[model samples]
Target: MTAAAAMVRVEGLCKRFSVPRREAGLRAALRALVRREYRVVEAVRDLEFSLAPGERVGFLGPNGAGKTTTLKMLAGLIVPSAGRVEVAGFTPSDRRPEFLRRVSLVMGQKRQLSWDLPAIDNFEFNRVVYEIDPVHYKRRLEELTALLDVGEVMRRPVRQLSLGERMKCELVAALLHGPQVLFLDEPTIGLDVSMQLGIREFIRRYNAEHGATVILTSHYMEDVAALCPRILVIDGGRLRFDGSIEALRRQIRPLRRVSVRAAALPDDPTAMGRVVLREGGRLVLDVAPERVPEVVGALVALPEAQDLAVHDAPLEEVMRALFGREEAADLGGAIGHAR
Candidate 1:
């Protein structure tokens, strides 16, 4: 897609950093002071993707997989070493004021709001920074507060609020201007399950109402499952998988897991499927997708079978297997994220 038509567009994106190599120990530190050994690290390489307005997509990867680097580039916080990035019709590296006004970046590791003030005060500050009219700001604030359920605690000091409460207010502050695009980097980190669910719901509602384009990077699989229909998976500073969540599940791990709770132990669990896990009265089997129905039928017909359930393999295991395959094959080619 061209830059003008895409909410976000990237072509041959790369970000490289030179780092000083130093070993742990007083002698090594002292020696490195006079003569430093430098190493080039590529955070992102030849990355290309585009997003249309109102699309909610998840960015997935292990640590050091360039997720944050890509987000920072899109947010215009840093310039790429090479390549192009246009967000909302403006080149992010240019740091255009108009582009900044139409988007917001919420990073779990960083806070844009003042630490010493109440969340309401931060929201008011954003209103002034964005030059929002008083009437419109008030209306937006009311709507966000109602949606996030932060009405009562808006006046409370941000420092005193729990992590989850602070996260909700942080979202309100970031969104006070009604940004058209949002870059969320681990927005639900460090929150309880209920609070995480609330944040996920708020994100979905906000996107549905405003047609906001959202790029979410989160470790919680459930958050991605609930919010993103599509996902971009990166590994070792390169794109590994980009497609629907189901497609990723199928490509990385084609097997289905069938768990059966049996009334008694079977003479041979392998007859049903490859025994993956077994305990007191429960047997977990890894069966090919095509064989899942057959295996389940056979197991259900067994006299000892009590109950059976089938599920796709866990995402963590899929990723682990993917990386393992990459290591064995040594294939570092970038995978394009298709719309």
Candidate 2:
């Protein structure tokens, strides 16, 4: 999409920080007391992308890959050292009142509600802070509470609510002003499977009803796989991949996965394809896309094979191969410490 048509635009984005350096000795520490040594770390490097209105995109990367830093920059929590970012036609770093009203940022680990007070109190507080019309706020709150199924918990103290309830309230508070853009960083973090699904559905419904552009970052692959059609992957503080999830699969991993349950094992499973796993009566194979039909046919013909299934490689495996786990591990340690 053209920049004008996009709700969010980032160009040549870069964020750098100068971190103090010190050795592991008392002498070095004493020397640093007088003068400190510093090194520049690039938290985000040359990021360029645009999100059209109502688009749901996943921002993915390993730990310390600049995912959170980029989200902070886009949400106006931090300024980029270099680059231009425009969200809903306003420069984020400017943090103008109008801009703030049009966008909301929700970090799962952060809480905006008062712990000692009821969640409804926090909701009312937000209405005043955002200057939301009382009538509009009431209608919006009712709608959000109903959709998130958090009405029963709204009157309870924030500290008394469970994590899932708290997260729902957090989302409700963030959306009270009716934002056109949302930055969600690990919104489902620390939630159970059912709770995660509830939040995911709420996000999907909110985006659909409001036509809000959403950018989500999560450690849960299921969240990304279910909600986002497009994905942007970053590594080592650089934009490594940006495209549809299907495109990412095709580019990084072209093989299809075939699983079969049988009463007896085939002495040489390699005849069908590369054996990925073998456990007693079950076998999993990685077969080329073109060879799937042939492999499935072969497996079905086997007297021992009872159930056979064909599928694509899991997103986790695809991502692991794409990022190279070893490289990500090394970068995580170095970049995490620097940041």
Candidate 3:
């Protein structure tokens, strides 16, 4: 796509931080009272990717893997030490008013709403901060509050709200201005399954309706798998893979999970595939992709077979396989077709 067609354009994006270097001792601390040592850590290395409007993309990585750093750079919260980042056709680090107005960020571990203030008050404050027209603001506030089921909840102080409720309010505040880009860092960090699903559906619906570009960083693989069709895996401050979840699954872990419950099973299940579980009336195998059909047929023929299934390996297994590889693993384009 042309430059004009892409809503988020990142090329050779990089960030580094000068961290204070210290040893764990009072002697070392006293020595550093006048002069302290520092070490430069490369938080984000050269990264290149782009997203079209209305696309929900995720940044997946382990702790301190630069996923959040990359998001911060794109959101203009931190300036990159090198490389370029353009969001909505404006340089993010420049922090221009127009660019700031076009983007909103919601962090799960951080609170944007005032703890002492009611969430509705926070939403009204955002309206003034974004300089949104009163008529449009009222309509959007109503729309978002109703959709998120927070009409009455928003009247309570933020500190009194549940984690999920506060997050819903955070989303409402970020979106009142109708930003073209949304940055979400762990939007469902500490919520029950039902609450997570509700927020996930809300985000998906909002993106669908508003045509906003969403870039997410989350430790919950299910959230990424559910909300994003495309993901960029970052490891060691570099891009390890960039593709759909299915493609990533096929790349790092191509094994198909074939399982069945039956009265009788093969004496040597290992002959068919790698055995995952072997219990009375049930057997699960991680079969090679090419052998899946044969394995399924054999499993179905088992005496009194039931609950037969053939499916790609779970996303967690795929990610574990990817990250378990040595740091010397090949670059983004080279890793492929591993079973």
Candidate 4:
């Protein structure tokens, strides 16, 4: 999207942190204390990307490929070391009231609700803090609580609520003001499968119904695969890939997985592709894209072929292939420490 038309615009974005350096020994430590040395660590490296209004995009990266750093820059929590960031036509670091009102941030690992108070009370506090009109606040609260099934949960003390309940309340608080841009950082961390699914569906529904631009970061591959159509892959504090999940899967792992279950298994399965799994009446292979149809036909012709399936490589595998063992380990360490 063009800069003028984009809801979020960034160029040459970078973040550098000055870290104190000291030796291990006591004498060295004392000397360092008197004359402390510093080293510059580049956390985000000349990143460039933009998001259109109402678009849900994901930032994919190892532990600390500057995903949170970039989010903070966009949210105006911290200023970028260099480059320009305009969200809703306002620079983030300015922390202007207008800009803050236009955006909302939800972090899974953190809590914005007061632990001792009921979430309903906290919502009231937020209504005042965000300067939301009483009528609009009541309407939005009812809408969110009903949609998330959190009407009763919001009335209980936040500390007494289950993690799922608390997360639902968090979502309610974040959306009560009708933000145009929603930034989510690990929005579903440490929840059961059912809870995760509920949260996932809620986010999708909220985005669709409100048309809020959603920028998300999640360690769970399923979350990104389900929520984001477009993804930005970052490694070593730099943009690596930007495209749809299907495109990423195709680019990183070209093989198509074909599996079949037959009463009588094939004698020469290797002719089809690389054998991934083999057992009584079951065979799974990684076939080339062009050979998938031919292989599927052959497998289907087998006696009593009961179950047959064809799919691209899983998202986890695609991500593993995208980063090598040694390189990802090294970068994960340095970037994790920096973040």
Of the candidates shown, which would achieve the greatest lDDT relative to the real structure? 3
lDDT of candidates 1 onward, in order: 0.86, 0.89, 0.90, 0.89
Give the alpha carbon lDDT tens digit for every residue of 201-254 in model 1: 999999999999999999888888899988888777787777777787776678
What ranking emerges by TM-score with the best candidate at the front?
Answer: 3, 1, 2, 4
**Residue-wise C-alpha lDDT for candidate 4, range 1-339, written one tens digit per residue:** 678889999888999999899879999999997899999988898887788899999899888788999999999998999999999999999999999999999999999999999999999999998999999998999899999999888888999999999999999999999999999999899888999999999999999999999999999999999999988888777877777888777766789999989998888889999999999889999999999989998998999897799988999888888876445433322321221
Candidate 2 residue spans exceeding 4 A from truth? 325-339
| TM-score quality measure for candidate 4 | 0.92
Better of 2 and 3 by TM-score: 3
Q: Model 3 Cα displacement at 307 (Å)?
A: 1.7
Residue pairs with backbone overlap in model 4: none
As for model 1, its CA RMSD to the true structure in angstroms is 1.9
- Candidate 2 has an lDDT of 0.89
Predicted structure with the largest TM-score when compared to the true one: 3
